[model samples]
Target: MNVNGTLINYYFHCKRQCYFHGNRLNLEDNSENVSIGKALHEERNKCNNTEIEIENIKIDKLTKEYLIEVKKSDADVEAAKWQLLYYLKVLKNKGILRKGKLEFIEKNKTKKKILLFELTEENEKELCEITNNIKKLILQDDIPKVLNESKCKKCAYYEYCYI
Candidate 1:
């Protein structure tokens, strides 16, 4: 599987998470997040003017050039941002978009706006390094051990890693 920039950023956030999710591991038990996200996306799709599910990217209110991503948890925020960033990077690389705004809807209510920038050469380089590191870790089949620290209290994979 060719890992894209989105997955690369995810890898940076947590190697074990990236491995479990990227490799299609059957870890998550509930689809509540998926269902909620789909509903929100369907709402955005209702707008006649808005391009709904264009290719791999979904543009909410296309006229406004806004990308809407619904998050069920704060833990998903970072990965969501990286996904938006990857979309922006692809758009810029293909000369389709110069800039855009990222709107993250939290728990079906709160909204936060972020400006997506064109990925700089340095940013790409750093992402590449992270990607390589993640690939190495995954290929080695080494699941990173939990540090049993305070940070684990908030990790989505805390339960899985702790054991």
Candidate 2:
């Protein structure tokens, strides 16, 4: 199975979510927040000069120096960061090297955000470990535990997990 950027993001955000998605129990289509995010992604791609897609991964905008990821919000910035880093690793395996930029179109209450990252030896090693772990997690017979955090209130899987 291919480990796309979404899996990487979900692995960091919520293991149960990652496992559900990896196992093909998709709930994104039933989510209002997901709809908003998709709309934001469509808007972000409207004027981009170049967008590259590989399997399930989509690079929102690419430039000579950067592989860009556009996000609707910064609520899950760490997940977004790792997703972009995984994209960089994918390109590197194909002999293409570029930095990564995470762009949030809509700022959260406290701050505006635009972050840049580069793939390093350390990042590659960690991501490889994450990739393997995710592979194992998805194949397990049982779903991972629900996190039940404040974020769960907004998750698409909230009803499935709680009710």
Predictions in order: lDDT: 0.57, 0.88
Scored by lDDT, the top model is 2
Model 1: which ten-residue window has the lowest total lDDT?
62-71
Q: What range of 10 consecutive residues in model 2 has the weakest lDDT sum?
A: 104-113
Off by over 4 Å in 1: 47-78, 108-112, 147-163
Return the clash pairs for model 2, or none.
none
Query: Model 2 off-target regions past 4 Å?
Result: 107-111
Model 1 lDDT tens row, 1-163? 4566435645756666677766766444344444555676677667554654544555454344544443445554556566656666656666665444555555556566454544567866665676676667666666665556665555556667775
- Cα lDDT tens digits for candidate 2, 56-81: 67788778899988777788998999
lDDT value for model 1: 0.57
Clashing pairs in 1: none
